[model samples]
Target: MILVTGATGSIGRPLVRRLRRDGTAVRALVRDEAKGRALGCEFVVGDFDDPASIVAALAGVDRLLLNGAGALPADGEQPMVRQQKTIIDAALDAGVERVVKVSVWHAAEGGRLAEGAHWEIERHLKASGLSWSILQPNGFMQNFITGQGSFTADGNLVGAYGDGAVSYIDCADIAACAATLLTGPPRDGETFLLSGPQALTHTQIAEKLSAALGRTVHYVSLTADDMAAALISQGLAPRFADDVAVLTQGLASGIAAPTTTAVRDLTGRAPRTFDEFLAAHHEALAALAWAPSR
Candidate 1:
Protein backbone atom coordinates (compact mmCIF):
# COMPACT_ATOMS: atom_id res chain seq x y z
CA MET A 1 0.00 0.00 0.00
CA ILE A 2 1.11 3.60 -0.57
CA LEU A 3 1.01 6.04 2.34
CA VAL A 4 0.80 9.85 2.08
CA THR A 5 1.51 12.29 4.87
CA GLY A 6 0.02 15.81 5.00
CA ALA A 7 -2.92 14.42 3.04
CA THR A 8 -5.17 17.42 3.68
CA GLY A 9 -2.71 19.92 2.22
CA SER A 10 -2.74 21.49 -1.24
CA ILE A 11 -0.44 18.92 -2.78
CA GLY A 12 -1.55 15.86 -0.81
CA ARG A 13 -5.27 16.23 -1.49
CA PRO A 14 -4.79 16.27 -5.27
CA LEU A 15 -2.16 13.53 -5.05
CA VAL A 16 -4.51 11.23 -3.13
CA ARG A 17 -7.23 11.77 -5.72
CA ARG A 18 -4.86 11.04 -8.60
CA LEU A 19 -3.46 7.91 -6.96
CA ARG A 20 -6.92 6.55 -6.18
CA ARG A 21 -8.12 7.22 -9.69
CA ASP A 22 -5.13 5.26 -10.97
CA GLY A 23 -6.09 2.27 -8.74
CA THR A 24 -3.29 2.56 -6.20
CA ALA A 25 -4.06 1.25 -2.71
CA VAL A 26 -3.69 4.47 -0.71
CA ARG A 27 -3.64 5.28 2.98
CA ALA A 28 -3.52 8.80 4.37
CA LEU A 29 -1.79 9.70 7.63
CA VAL A 30 -3.80 12.55 9.05
CA ARG A 31 -4.13 14.10 12.47
CA ASP A 32 -7.91 14.41 12.25
CA GLU A 33 -10.30 11.52 11.56
CA ALA A 34 -12.92 13.74 9.95
CA LYS A 35 -10.49 15.18 7.43
CA GLY A 36 -9.10 11.74 6.77
CA ARG A 37 -12.58 10.31 6.24
CA ALA A 38 -13.43 13.19 3.95
CA LEU A 39 -10.44 12.17 1.79
CA GLY A 40 -11.98 8.73 1.09
CA CYS A 41 -8.74 6.93 1.83
CA GLU A 42 -7.78 4.35 4.39
CA PHE A 43 -7.02 6.63 7.36
CA VAL A 44 -4.38 6.45 10.06
CA VAL A 45 -4.58 9.06 12.80
CA GLY A 46 -1.05 10.11 13.70
CA ASP A 47 0.79 13.17 14.86
CA PHE A 48 4.36 13.57 13.55
CA ASP A 49 5.46 14.84 16.97
CA ASP A 50 4.78 11.35 18.33
CA PRO A 51 7.13 8.65 17.03
CA ALA A 52 4.82 5.82 18.01
CA SER A 53 2.11 7.34 15.85
CA ILE A 54 4.47 7.45 12.88
CA VAL A 55 5.32 3.81 13.46
CA ALA A 56 1.65 2.95 13.54
CA ALA A 57 1.06 4.86 10.34
CA LEU A 58 3.78 2.91 8.51
CA ALA A 59 2.24 -0.48 9.05
CA GLY A 60 1.54 -2.33 5.77
CA VAL A 61 2.81 0.57 3.69
CA ASP A 62 5.22 -0.13 0.90
CA ARG A 63 5.78 3.33 -0.60
CA LEU A 64 5.59 6.69 1.20
CA LEU A 65 5.28 10.38 0.30
CA LEU A 66 6.79 12.60 2.99
CA ASN A 67 5.33 16.08 2.46
CA GLY A 68 5.72 18.14 5.64
CA ALA A 69 4.32 21.49 6.72
CA GLY A 70 6.67 24.54 6.74
CA ALA A 71 6.56 26.14 10.20
CA LEU A 72 9.18 25.33 12.88
CA PRO A 73 10.26 27.14 16.04
CA ALA A 74 13.69 28.79 15.87
CA ASP A 75 14.62 28.74 19.58
CA GLY A 76 13.61 25.11 20.15
CA GLU A 77 14.38 21.69 18.71
CA GLN A 78 13.16 21.41 15.15
CA PRO A 79 9.98 19.34 15.31
CA MET A 80 10.11 18.56 11.58
CA VAL A 81 13.68 17.33 11.79
CA ARG A 82 12.72 15.01 14.68
CA GLN A 83 9.58 13.93 12.83
CA GLN A 84 11.53 13.13 9.68
CA LYS A 85 14.01 11.05 11.62
CA THR A 86 11.18 9.20 13.36
CA ILE A 87 9.36 8.55 10.09
CA ILE A 88 12.51 7.31 8.38
CA ASP A 89 13.31 5.04 11.29
CA ALA A 90 9.79 3.63 11.31
CA ALA A 91 9.79 3.18 7.54
CA LEU A 92 13.05 1.30 7.84
CA ASP A 93 11.66 -0.84 10.65
CA ALA A 94 8.51 -1.54 8.65
CA GLY A 95 10.59 -2.41 5.57
CA VAL A 96 8.92 0.14 3.33
CA GLU A 97 10.54 -0.06 -0.08
CA ARG A 98 10.51 3.49 -1.41
CA VAL A 99 10.17 7.06 -0.12
CA VAL A 100 9.61 10.37 -1.89
CA LYS A 101 10.41 13.54 0.05
CA VAL A 102 9.20 17.03 -0.88
CA SER A 103 11.71 19.75 -0.23
CA VAL A 104 11.96 23.40 -1.27
CA TRP A 105 14.40 25.01 -3.66
CA HIS A 106 17.78 25.94 -2.12
CA ALA A 107 17.12 23.61 0.84
CA ALA A 108 20.86 23.09 1.12
CA GLU A 109 21.58 26.82 1.47
CA GLY A 110 20.96 26.55 5.26
CA GLY A 111 19.44 29.93 6.12
CA ARG A 112 15.66 29.76 6.04
CA LEU A 113 14.33 27.64 8.90
CA ALA A 114 12.05 25.51 6.69
CA GLU A 115 14.73 24.92 4.07
CA GLY A 116 17.34 24.13 6.74
CA ALA A 117 15.11 21.48 8.30
CA HIS A 118 14.45 19.99 4.87
CA TRP A 119 18.18 19.88 4.20
CA GLU A 120 18.67 17.76 7.33
CA ILE A 121 15.78 15.52 6.34
CA GLU A 122 17.25 15.08 2.87
CA ARG A 123 20.52 13.96 4.41
CA HIS A 124 18.70 11.46 6.62
CA LEU A 125 16.67 10.12 3.70
CA LYS A 126 19.86 9.55 1.72
CA ALA A 127 21.31 7.31 4.42
CA SER A 128 18.07 5.45 5.28
CA GLY A 129 18.81 2.49 2.91
CA LEU A 130 15.50 2.86 1.05
CA SER A 131 14.90 3.75 -2.58
CA TRP A 132 14.49 7.53 -2.34
CA SER A 133 13.73 10.51 -4.60
CA ILE A 134 13.82 14.12 -3.44
CA LEU A 135 11.74 16.84 -5.09
CA GLN A 136 12.95 20.42 -4.66
CA PRO A 137 10.26 22.63 -6.05
CA ASN A 138 10.24 26.42 -6.32
CA GLY A 139 7.50 28.52 -4.74
CA PHE A 140 3.90 27.52 -5.36
CA MET A 141 1.68 29.58 -7.66
CA GLN A 142 -1.21 29.03 -5.24
CA ASN A 143 0.49 31.33 -2.72
CA PHE A 144 -0.87 34.30 -4.65
CA ILE A 145 -4.46 33.08 -4.51
CA THR A 146 -4.22 32.15 -0.82
CA GLY A 147 -3.09 35.58 0.46
CA GLN A 148 0.27 34.38 1.76
CA GLY A 149 2.96 37.11 1.77
CA SER A 150 0.93 39.72 -0.03
CA PHE A 151 -2.41 40.76 -1.50
CA THR A 152 -4.13 43.08 -3.93
CA ALA A 153 -5.56 46.47 -3.09
CA ASP A 154 -8.15 47.28 -5.78
CA GLY A 155 -6.22 45.79 -8.73
CA ASN A 156 -2.64 45.90 -7.47
CA LEU A 157 -0.54 42.97 -6.20
CA VAL A 158 1.39 44.12 -3.12
CA GLY A 159 4.52 42.37 -1.84
CA ALA A 160 8.18 42.76 -0.87
CA TYR A 161 9.48 41.08 -4.02
CA GLY A 162 10.58 44.16 -5.93
CA ASP A 163 11.19 42.99 -9.50
CA GLY A 164 12.80 39.58 -9.22
CA ALA A 165 11.37 36.80 -11.34
CA VAL A 166 10.27 33.43 -9.93
CA SER A 167 9.66 30.19 -11.72
CA TYR A 168 6.78 29.09 -9.51
CA ILE A 169 5.05 25.79 -10.28
CA ASP A 170 1.49 24.86 -9.59
CA CYS A 171 0.93 22.65 -6.55
CA ALA A 172 -0.92 20.13 -8.72
CA ASP A 173 2.21 19.70 -10.79
CA ILE A 174 4.17 18.91 -7.66
CA ALA A 175 1.54 16.33 -6.64
CA ALA A 176 1.66 14.76 -10.11
CA CYS A 177 5.41 14.40 -9.90
CA ALA A 178 5.09 12.82 -6.46
CA ALA A 179 2.60 10.24 -7.77
CA THR A 180 4.91 9.39 -10.67
CA LEU A 181 7.94 8.96 -8.42
CA LEU A 182 6.02 6.65 -6.10
CA THR A 183 4.65 4.37 -8.84
CA GLY A 184 7.33 4.46 -11.51
CA PRO A 185 10.65 2.66 -11.67
CA PRO A 186 12.98 3.09 -8.72
CA ARG A 187 14.64 6.51 -8.84
CA ASP A 188 16.89 5.84 -5.90
CA GLY A 189 18.96 8.83 -4.81
CA GLU A 190 17.54 11.16 -7.44
CA THR A 191 16.62 14.82 -6.92
CA PHE A 192 14.28 16.77 -9.19
CA LEU A 193 13.94 20.57 -9.39
CA LEU A 194 10.34 21.25 -10.33
CA SER A 195 9.51 24.69 -11.66
CA GLY A 196 7.12 26.44 -14.01
CA PRO A 197 7.64 26.88 -17.75
CA GLN A 198 8.48 30.59 -17.44
CA ALA A 199 10.05 32.93 -14.90
CA LEU A 200 7.95 35.91 -13.85
CA THR A 201 8.27 38.86 -11.55
CA HIS A 202 5.50 40.03 -9.23
CA THR A 203 4.71 42.70 -11.80
CA GLN A 204 4.47 40.08 -14.52
CA ILE A 205 2.25 37.93 -12.33
CA ALA A 206 -0.03 40.87 -11.76
CA GLU A 207 -0.22 41.49 -15.50
CA LYS A 208 -1.17 37.85 -16.08
CA LEU A 209 -3.89 38.06 -13.48
CA SER A 210 -5.15 41.19 -15.14
CA ALA A 211 -5.30 39.51 -18.52
CA ALA A 212 -7.08 36.48 -17.09
CA LEU A 213 -9.62 38.54 -15.17
CA GLY A 214 -9.97 41.16 -17.91
CA ARG A 215 -9.04 43.95 -15.49
CA THR A 216 -5.92 45.99 -14.93
CA VAL A 217 -3.74 44.91 -12.00
CA HIS A 218 -0.62 46.55 -10.62
CA TYR A 219 2.34 45.33 -8.53
CA VAL A 220 3.18 47.38 -5.45
CA SER A 221 6.55 46.79 -3.86
CA LEU A 222 7.23 47.22 -0.13
CA THR A 223 10.39 47.50 1.99
CA ALA A 224 11.47 44.42 3.97
CA ASP A 225 10.79 46.08 7.31
CA ASP A 226 7.35 47.21 6.17
CA MET A 227 6.61 43.72 4.91
CA ALA A 228 7.73 42.23 8.23
CA ALA A 229 5.44 44.53 10.16
CA ALA A 230 2.57 43.71 7.80
CA LEU A 231 3.05 39.98 8.28
CA ILE A 232 3.32 40.41 12.07
CA SER A 233 0.07 42.37 12.08
CA GLN A 234 -1.48 39.37 10.33
CA GLY A 235 -0.63 37.23 13.43
CA LEU A 236 2.64 35.51 12.51
CA ALA A 237 5.41 35.57 15.14
CA PRO A 238 7.76 38.53 14.91
CA ARG A 239 10.85 36.47 14.17
CA PHE A 240 9.14 34.34 11.53
CA ALA A 241 7.62 37.40 9.94
CA ASP A 242 11.01 39.08 9.85
CA ASP A 243 12.65 35.99 8.41
CA VAL A 244 10.01 35.74 5.71
CA ALA A 245 10.46 39.39 4.88
CA VAL A 246 14.16 38.82 4.47
CA LEU A 247 13.44 35.77 2.35
CA THR A 248 11.29 37.88 0.08
CA GLN A 249 14.19 40.26 -0.31
CA GLY A 250 16.34 37.29 -1.28
CA LEU A 251 13.74 36.25 -3.83
CA ALA A 252 13.63 39.80 -5.14
CA SER A 253 17.38 39.62 -5.71
CA GLY A 254 16.88 36.63 -8.08
CA ILE A 255 18.24 33.99 -5.72
CA ALA A 256 15.21 31.75 -6.43
CA ALA A 257 14.76 32.54 -10.11
CA PRO A 258 15.30 29.56 -12.35
CA THR A 259 13.12 27.54 -14.73
CA THR A 260 13.26 23.78 -15.14
CA THR A 261 11.81 20.98 -17.27
CA ALA A 262 11.58 18.38 -14.52
CA VAL A 263 7.84 18.74 -14.09
CA ARG A 264 7.18 18.09 -17.78
CA ASP A 265 9.79 15.38 -17.93
CA LEU A 266 8.15 13.48 -15.07
CA THR A 267 4.49 14.18 -15.82
CA GLY A 268 4.74 14.07 -19.63
CA ARG A 269 3.35 17.60 -19.99
CA ALA A 270 4.58 21.14 -19.68
CA PRO A 271 4.39 22.75 -16.26
CA ARG A 272 1.43 25.07 -15.92
CA THR A 273 2.17 28.63 -16.97
CA PHE A 274 1.34 31.62 -14.80
CA ASP A 275 -1.47 32.47 -17.22
CA GLU A 276 -2.85 28.96 -16.93
CA PHE A 277 -2.68 29.14 -13.15
CA LEU A 278 -4.39 32.51 -13.09
CA ALA A 279 -7.10 31.25 -15.45
CA ALA A 280 -7.72 28.18 -13.33
CA HIS A 281 -7.97 30.24 -10.16
CA HIS A 282 -9.75 33.28 -11.63
CA GLU A 283 -12.92 32.82 -9.63
CA ALA A 284 -11.12 32.81 -6.32
CA LEU A 285 -9.14 35.88 -7.26
CA ALA A 286 -12.30 37.68 -8.27
CA ALA A 287 -13.96 36.86 -4.97
CA LEU A 288 -11.27 38.36 -2.78
CA ALA A 289 -12.28 41.73 -1.30
CA TRP A 290 -8.95 43.49 -0.95
CA ALA A 291 -8.26 45.07 2.41
CA PRO A 292 -7.73 48.84 2.29
CA SER A 293 -4.28 50.23 3.08
CA ARG A 294 -3.89 50.96 6.82
Candidate 2:
Protein backbone atom coordinates (compact mmCIF):
# COMPACT_ATOMS: atom_id res chain seq x y z
CA MET A 1 0.00 0.00 0.00
CA ILE A 2 1.11 3.58 -0.74
CA LEU A 3 0.40 6.50 1.57
CA VAL A 4 0.21 9.98 0.09
CA THR A 5 0.59 12.90 2.45
CA GLY A 6 -0.81 16.32 1.49
CA ALA A 7 -3.26 14.46 -0.69
CA THR A 8 -5.66 17.38 -1.07
CA GLY A 9 -3.04 19.69 -2.50
CA SER A 10 -2.52 20.72 -6.14
CA ILE A 11 -0.06 17.92 -6.88
CA GLY A 12 -1.33 15.30 -4.49
CA ARG A 13 -4.97 15.30 -5.60
CA PRO A 14 -4.02 14.55 -9.19
CA LEU A 15 -1.39 12.07 -8.09
CA VAL A 16 -3.92 10.05 -6.16
CA ARG A 17 -6.19 10.00 -9.19
CA ARG A 18 -3.39 8.88 -11.49
CA LEU A 19 -2.26 6.13 -9.12
CA ARG A 20 -5.76 4.79 -8.73
CA ARG A 21 -6.36 4.95 -12.48
CA ASP A 22 -3.16 3.00 -12.98
CA GLY A 23 -4.50 0.29 -10.59
CA THR A 24 -2.30 1.05 -7.57
CA ALA A 25 -3.70 0.77 -4.06
CA VAL A 26 -3.47 4.26 -2.52
CA ARG A 27 -4.36 5.92 0.74
CA ALA A 28 -4.41 9.62 1.56
CA LEU A 29 -3.30 11.16 4.83
CA VAL A 30 -5.62 14.00 5.67
CA ARG A 31 -6.33 16.22 8.64
CA ASP A 32 -10.08 16.25 8.17
CA GLU A 33 -12.37 13.21 8.07
CA ALA A 34 -14.62 14.73 5.42
CA LYS A 35 -11.63 15.50 3.23
CA GLY A 36 -10.45 11.96 3.63
CA ARG A 37 -13.81 10.56 2.51
CA ALA A 38 -13.91 12.92 -0.44
CA LEU A 39 -10.65 11.54 -1.76
CA GLY A 40 -12.53 8.44 -3.08
CA CYS A 41 -9.71 6.26 -1.81
CA GLU A 42 -8.85 4.77 1.53
CA PHE A 43 -7.55 7.50 3.83
CA VAL A 44 -6.64 8.13 7.43
CA VAL A 45 -6.69 11.26 9.53
CA GLY A 46 -3.17 12.30 10.41
CA ASP A 47 -1.08 15.35 11.06
CA PHE A 48 2.62 15.91 10.71
CA ASP A 49 2.51 17.65 14.07
CA ASP A 50 1.14 14.48 15.62
CA PRO A 51 3.79 11.77 15.60
CA ALA A 52 1.52 9.02 16.86
CA SER A 53 -1.04 9.68 14.16
CA ILE A 54 1.66 9.33 11.53
CA VAL A 55 2.81 6.03 12.98
CA ALA A 56 -0.71 4.63 12.80
CA ALA A 57 -1.22 5.94 9.28
CA LEU A 58 1.99 4.43 7.98
CA ALA A 59 1.13 0.97 9.14
CA GLY A 60 1.14 -1.56 6.27
CA VAL A 61 2.23 1.14 3.84
CA ASP A 62 5.36 0.30 1.90
CA ARG A 63 5.70 3.48 -0.17
CA LEU A 64 5.21 7.07 0.93
CA LEU A 65 4.66 10.28 -1.00
CA LEU A 66 5.93 12.91 1.42
CA ASN A 67 4.61 16.43 0.88
CA GLY A 68 2.94 19.13 2.89
CA ALA A 69 2.59 22.88 3.26
CA GLY A 70 5.60 25.06 2.57
CA ALA A 71 7.54 27.45 4.80
CA LEU A 72 5.33 29.10 7.38
CA PRO A 73 6.03 31.69 10.04
CA ALA A 74 7.17 30.20 13.33
CA ASP A 75 9.16 32.62 15.40
CA GLY A 76 11.47 33.35 12.47
CA GLU A 77 11.97 29.65 11.73
CA GLN A 78 10.46 27.44 9.05
CA PRO A 79 8.04 25.00 10.68
CA MET A 80 8.41 22.60 7.73
CA VAL A 81 12.00 21.97 8.79
CA ARG A 82 10.68 20.34 11.95
CA GLN A 83 7.43 19.07 10.49
CA GLN A 84 8.94 17.15 7.59
CA LYS A 85 11.73 15.84 9.80
CA THR A 86 9.08 14.33 12.01
CA ILE A 87 7.47 12.62 9.01
CA ILE A 88 10.84 11.32 7.94
CA ASP A 89 11.35 9.78 11.38
CA ALA A 90 7.91 8.14 11.29
CA ALA A 91 8.44 6.85 7.74
CA LEU A 92 11.67 5.28 8.89
CA ASP A 93 10.00 3.62 11.84
CA ALA A 94 7.09 2.39 9.72
CA GLY A 95 9.54 0.48 7.53
CA VAL A 96 8.37 2.30 4.45
CA GLU A 97 10.36 0.79 1.56
CA ARG A 98 10.60 4.00 -0.46
CA VAL A 99 9.79 7.71 0.00
CA VAL A 100 9.31 10.36 -2.65
CA LYS A 101 9.40 14.05 -1.63
CA VAL A 102 8.67 17.35 -3.35
CA SER A 103 11.38 19.93 -2.94
CA VAL A 104 12.26 23.25 -4.60
CA TRP A 105 14.69 24.35 -7.27
CA HIS A 106 17.94 25.87 -6.00
CA ALA A 107 17.54 23.94 -2.75
CA ALA A 108 20.80 23.66 -0.86
CA GLU A 109 22.30 24.02 2.60
CA GLY A 110 21.89 27.57 3.91
CA GLY A 111 19.73 28.57 0.94
CA ARG A 112 17.04 31.13 1.68
CA LEU A 113 13.40 30.40 2.63
CA ALA A 114 11.83 27.11 1.43
CA GLU A 115 15.07 26.19 -0.27
CA GLY A 116 16.84 25.83 3.07
CA ALA A 117 13.89 24.20 4.80
CA HIS A 118 13.52 21.57 2.05
CA TRP A 119 17.26 20.93 1.99
CA GLU A 120 17.32 20.19 5.70
CA ILE A 121 14.45 17.71 5.35
CA GLU A 122 16.12 16.14 2.30
CA ARG A 123 19.22 15.53 4.37
CA HIS A 124 17.24 13.75 7.06
CA LEU A 125 15.35 11.61 4.53
CA LYS A 126 18.64 10.57 2.92
CA ALA A 127 20.18 9.60 6.25
CA SER A 128 17.17 7.47 7.09
CA GLY A 129 17.31 3.80 6.02
CA LEU A 130 14.32 4.27 3.66
CA SER A 131 14.95 4.75 -0.08
CA TRP A 132 14.18 8.24 -1.47
CA SER A 133 13.71 10.29 -4.63
CA ILE A 134 13.63 14.09 -4.35
CA LEU A 135 11.82 16.16 -6.95
CA GLN A 136 13.29 19.66 -7.08
CA PRO A 137 11.02 21.61 -9.36
CA ASN A 138 10.93 25.20 -10.58
CA GLY A 139 8.05 27.63 -10.01
CA PHE A 140 4.61 26.10 -10.55
CA MET A 141 2.77 27.29 -13.66
CA GLN A 142 -0.44 27.10 -11.62
CA ASN A 143 0.85 30.10 -9.68
CA PHE A 144 -0.30 32.45 -12.42
CA ILE A 145 -3.95 31.44 -12.27
CA THR A 146 -4.13 30.62 -8.58
CA GLY A 147 -3.07 34.03 -7.26
CA GLN A 148 0.17 32.49 -6.01
CA GLY A 149 2.80 34.76 -7.57
CA SER A 150 1.33 36.42 -10.62
CA PHE A 151 -0.37 39.59 -9.47
CA THR A 152 -0.43 42.74 -7.44
CA ALA A 153 -3.61 44.15 -5.90
CA ASP A 154 -4.25 46.02 -9.12
CA GLY A 155 -3.96 42.88 -11.26
CA ASN A 156 -0.56 43.31 -12.87
CA LEU A 157 1.99 40.58 -13.43
CA VAL A 158 4.21 41.25 -10.44
CA GLY A 159 7.68 39.78 -10.08
CA ALA A 160 11.30 40.63 -9.24
CA TYR A 161 12.56 38.89 -12.36
CA GLY A 162 14.16 41.62 -14.45
CA ASP A 163 13.80 40.25 -17.98
CA GLY A 164 15.14 36.87 -16.83
CA ALA A 165 13.28 33.73 -17.84
CA VAL A 166 11.89 31.19 -15.38
CA SER A 167 11.30 27.62 -16.45
CA TYR A 168 7.97 27.25 -14.71
CA ILE A 169 6.28 23.80 -14.79
CA ASP A 170 2.91 22.20 -14.25
CA CYS A 171 2.27 20.41 -10.99
CA ALA A 172 0.54 17.64 -12.97
CA ASP A 173 3.88 16.79 -14.52
CA ILE A 174 5.46 16.76 -11.10
CA ALA A 175 2.70 14.44 -9.87
CA ALA A 176 3.26 12.13 -12.82
CA CYS A 177 6.90 11.82 -11.85
CA ALA A 178 5.94 11.03 -8.26
CA ALA A 179 3.41 8.36 -9.34
CA THR A 180 6.09 6.73 -11.48
CA LEU A 181 8.62 6.74 -8.65
CA LEU A 182 6.17 5.38 -6.09
CA THR A 183 4.84 2.53 -8.28
CA GLY A 184 8.01 1.58 -10.15
CA PRO A 185 11.35 0.27 -8.91
CA PRO A 186 13.23 2.42 -6.48
CA ARG A 187 15.53 5.09 -7.91
CA ASP A 188 17.14 5.63 -4.54
CA GLY A 189 19.08 8.76 -3.62
CA GLU A 190 18.32 10.42 -6.94
CA THR A 191 17.35 14.12 -7.14
CA PHE A 192 15.43 15.16 -10.25
CA LEU A 193 15.33 18.83 -11.31
CA LEU A 194 12.08 19.44 -13.22
CA SER A 195 11.21 22.38 -15.44
CA GLY A 196 8.96 23.45 -18.33
CA PRO A 197 9.85 22.93 -21.97
CA GLN A 198 11.11 26.50 -22.33
CA ALA A 199 12.11 29.49 -20.25
CA LEU A 200 9.99 32.64 -20.50
CA THR A 201 10.55 36.03 -18.97
CA HIS A 202 7.91 37.98 -17.02
CA THR A 203 7.23 40.13 -20.08
CA GLN A 204 6.61 37.08 -22.19
CA ILE A 205 4.44 35.56 -19.51
CA ALA A 206 2.30 38.69 -19.30
CA GLU A 207 1.93 38.59 -23.04
CA LYS A 208 0.71 35.03 -22.84
CA LEU A 209 -1.77 35.98 -20.14
CA SER A 210 -3.01 38.81 -22.30
CA ALA A 211 -3.55 36.54 -25.26
CA ALA A 212 -5.27 33.96 -23.12
CA LEU A 213 -7.41 36.41 -21.18
CA GLY A 214 -8.18 38.65 -24.16
CA ARG A 215 -7.22 41.66 -22.10
CA THR A 216 -4.15 43.77 -21.61
CA VAL A 217 -2.05 42.49 -18.71
CA HIS A 218 1.18 44.26 -17.83
CA TYR A 219 4.39 43.17 -16.12
CA VAL A 220 5.33 45.25 -13.11
CA SER A 221 8.88 44.75 -11.90
CA LEU A 222 9.72 45.21 -8.25
CA THR A 223 13.20 45.53 -6.85
CA ALA A 224 14.43 43.30 -4.06
CA ASP A 225 13.75 46.02 -1.53
CA ASP A 226 10.31 46.62 -2.96
CA MET A 227 9.41 42.95 -2.61
CA ALA A 228 10.61 42.90 0.98
CA ALA A 229 8.52 45.93 1.83
CA ALA A 230 5.48 44.40 0.16
CA LEU A 231 5.85 41.22 2.18
CA ILE A 232 6.15 43.22 5.37
CA SER A 233 3.05 45.14 4.42
CA GLN A 234 1.26 41.83 4.08
CA GLY A 235 2.04 41.10 7.78
CA LEU A 236 5.04 38.84 7.25
CA ALA A 237 7.82 39.19 9.77
CA PRO A 238 10.48 41.64 8.65
CA ARG A 239 13.22 39.03 8.85
CA PHE A 240 11.18 36.52 6.88
CA ALA A 241 10.28 39.18 4.36
CA ASP A 242 13.93 40.03 3.89
CA ASP A 243 14.84 36.41 3.42
CA VAL A 244 12.17 35.97 0.73
CA ALA A 245 13.39 39.13 -0.93
CA VAL A 246 16.86 37.64 -1.20
CA LEU A 247 15.44 34.59 -2.97
CA THR A 248 13.32 36.78 -5.25
CA GLN A 249 16.35 38.82 -6.27
CA GLY A 250 18.19 35.62 -7.02
CA LEU A 251 15.59 35.02 -9.74
CA ALA A 252 16.91 38.09 -11.56
CA SER A 253 20.06 36.16 -12.32
CA GLY A 254 18.25 33.51 -14.36
CA ILE A 255 18.21 31.04 -11.49
CA ALA A 256 15.58 28.91 -13.27
CA ALA A 257 16.89 29.09 -16.82
CA PRO A 258 17.97 25.51 -17.34
CA THR A 259 15.28 23.19 -18.70
CA THR A 260 16.25 19.65 -17.88
CA THR A 261 15.14 16.36 -19.46
CA ALA A 262 14.45 14.83 -16.05
CA VAL A 263 10.66 15.07 -16.35
CA ARG A 264 10.64 13.44 -19.78
CA ASP A 265 13.27 10.95 -18.73
CA LEU A 266 11.18 9.83 -15.78
CA THR A 267 7.61 10.26 -17.11
CA GLY A 268 8.30 9.27 -20.74
CA ARG A 269 7.23 12.58 -22.31
CA ALA A 270 8.35 16.17 -22.64
CA PRO A 271 7.16 18.45 -19.88
CA ARG A 272 4.39 20.88 -20.79
CA THR A 273 5.30 24.26 -22.22
CA PHE A 274 4.05 27.48 -20.63
CA ASP A 275 1.61 27.95 -23.50
CA GLU A 276 0.28 24.47 -22.99
CA PHE A 277 -0.07 25.13 -19.29
CA LEU A 278 -2.09 28.24 -19.96
CA ALA A 279 -4.16 26.35 -22.49
CA ALA A 280 -4.87 23.50 -20.10
CA HIS A 281 -5.86 26.00 -17.40
CA HIS A 282 -7.72 28.38 -19.69
CA GLU A 283 -10.95 28.53 -17.75
CA ALA A 284 -9.24 29.30 -14.48
CA LEU A 285 -7.10 31.97 -16.10
CA ALA A 286 -10.14 33.38 -17.82
CA ALA A 287 -11.96 33.54 -14.51
CA LEU A 288 -9.05 35.47 -13.07
CA ALA A 289 -9.50 38.07 -15.77
CA TRP A 290 -12.92 38.88 -14.34
CA ALA A 291 -12.23 38.57 -10.62
CA PRO A 292 -11.52 41.58 -8.45
CA SER A 293 -7.80 42.22 -8.13
CA ARG A 294 -6.24 41.38 -4.82
Global lDDT of each candidate: 0.85, 0.86
- Could you list the CA RMSD of all candidates, in the order they appear? 2.4, 1.8
Q: How well is each residue in 19-90 modelled by candidate 2, as lDDT tens digits?
A: 989889999999999988988999999898888999999999999999987645636766788888888888
Pairs in clash, predicted candidate 2: 153-294
TM-score, predicted candidate 1 vs. hidden true structure: 0.92
Q: Which stretches of candidate 2 lie over 4 Å from their true place?
A: 74-76, 147-149, 235-237, 292-294
Residue 244 lDDT (model 2): 69
lDDT of 1 by residue, 43-159 (tens): 899999888888888989999999877754544345788888889889999999999999988897476757888999999989889889999999888777664556644647777
Q: Residue 241: error of model 2 in Å? A: 3.3
TM-score of each model, paired residue for residue: 0.92, 0.94
